[model samples]
Target: MKYPLFITQHGELKRESNSLVFSGELIKKAIPLAQISEIHCLARVSLTSGAIDILSEKSIPVHFYTTKGDYKGSFINDASPRGKLHLKQAEHYLNPEKRAYIAQQMVQGIQNNMAFTLSRWGINPVKLNSISVEGSSMEELMGIEAQLWNLYYAYFGEVLGVKDFKRTRRPPEDEINALISYGNGVVYGLALSSVLKAGLDPSIGFLHEPSEKRYSLALDIADVFKPLYVFSTIKALIKNKVMKRSDFSRNKNSVYLSREGKRKFLEALTDTLRRTVYYKPWRRSMSYRFMMDYEARRLVRHLKGKSKYKAFKPWWR
Candidate 1:
């Protein structure tokens, strides 16, 4: 099965025959092109022109992150563009009522998954009774989302026994925040891959305003899955004490996962993505990774007027 290729070492990637080869100071490895779903460079990794050619030809994205795991950008090859579908997607964004509906559903999905996840962890989530989207402005909806996440963070810290588990970014202040930042970056890349697969313009978003500097649509979609994927991975790691103190490094007040810590987190996340859960629509088990793609397709169907868009909740829900 194709899996995301994570380059954690400073290396140079080159195309050797039909495979991609990574050569570093102490290590060299060749990977079959077909086995890679996407490429993520968490370290300084340079891609040769030939490697770029094949990757673009294969329509695979290469995401880059800083040493602190902050997303820099991506090299995306849009090999296929659905012109009509894109126009429809833009229409949803342009129409205030339609944009409000999609944004509300996305937030609702985040709230439901947060509650369900907390309950599964033996914590009672705070009820969000005040979040009604009807006749609500975009700012109000965004404020509600902020409120929900703040509650989630409180519960998350409480359950994990992390003192003051506040959310921080741009070099997270605490260990929990560090893990969250890194994990969210990974999920953002995955969400972008899903969006591209559905042929949707990643820059056109409903919840987050579209900006030329970032793919805001991926950010919108990533929020829905972060509670399920990123938080769960952090919880498991902390609960089992899988990460060691050496797995982290500190630079003044900012904390970051060491290279070892990143590998551990990625391994656990890969397993989580591979684990199958029953999908009600298909009546069969599907991987979380597959579900991400399906979630994007659901939006496409909604835009095409084939069906109404509802954010993905757990099958049990």
Candidate 2:
């Protein structure tokens, strides 16, 4: 099975015949080009021009990050298509009908995600009086989202390992929040890589409007998968003592992932996605990457009118 390549070492990447090699101080090896979905160069990493050419030919984007774990910029050889897609999104946003359609899709995606998560714990969330999907329009969907947020937090104290972890929104003010956010970022990167491979326009999304530097569709899709991918991983990691309170930093204002914490968190999340899990919607088992790619393909179908787009429903059986 293919894997997302995380190049954490400071090195220069080169495209050798049929494979890619990373060589520099403290790093030397050939990466399997076929298996790499995306190349995440964390901290200081250099890439040769040949490596860029190979990755561009495969439509693989190299994501760069600063030493502080902040995102730098994505390297892609082509820019025209992304530019045109951005224009399309601006036009859609200007039209009321198109904007409404996109808003509905985003809400549907989040709603489906919440419903699926609740069902896993044998809870019928759709029947909850606290949660009501009133009205039929996009505006009403926001109301549904607010209700789901309440319901989601209510279950935090009940979920296995997290029962003891306090629930807080915004920056999560606690150790648990830091772990969750770190894991969520990993899942987002994984989903983004899959979306790129599917040839979908990540910048033109159904839920998130076009932005100057953000990929909104990736964020939308990541929302549906985060509870499944990130939350699940955190549960396992905490249960197994793979993470500790030292993995985070907190001030009165906010809590955040430490550098070492993020490294371990991403490592755990990557392993979780690599492990095959049975998905009820698909019947047969599939990897997390395959599920992400499938969702991207579904979006393309929605665009082509080949099939109606159904936001991914998290499965539990």
Q: What are the Cα lDDT values of the candidates?
A: 0.85, 0.67
Model 2 pairs in collision: none
Q: Model 1, 7: alpha-carbon shift in Å?
A: 2.2
TM-scores for all predictions: 0.90, 0.79
Residue-level lDDT of model 2, residues 1-317, one tens digit each, is 56677665667888787677888677689887778768777646787888887888876788887644445777875533544445554566577666566566656666666666556656677444344343346566656656665666566445653454556656667777766655565556766766676666677665555687767778767776776677667767776888667777877867787766776777877787787768666677777767777887776665555776665655545
Candidate 2 structure lDDT? 0.67
Residue-wise C-alpha lDDT for candidate 1, range 1-317, written one tens digit per residue: 46677788899988998777899767999977786778888889998998898889998889888876667888888888689998999999999989999998898888877887888899866554345545667889899989989989988988998777788888688788889989998898888888887999898989989888778999999999998889888998888889998988999999999999998998888877777777666778877777778889999999999999986778663
Residue 116 of model 2, lDDT score = 62
Which candidate leads in lDDT? Answer: 1
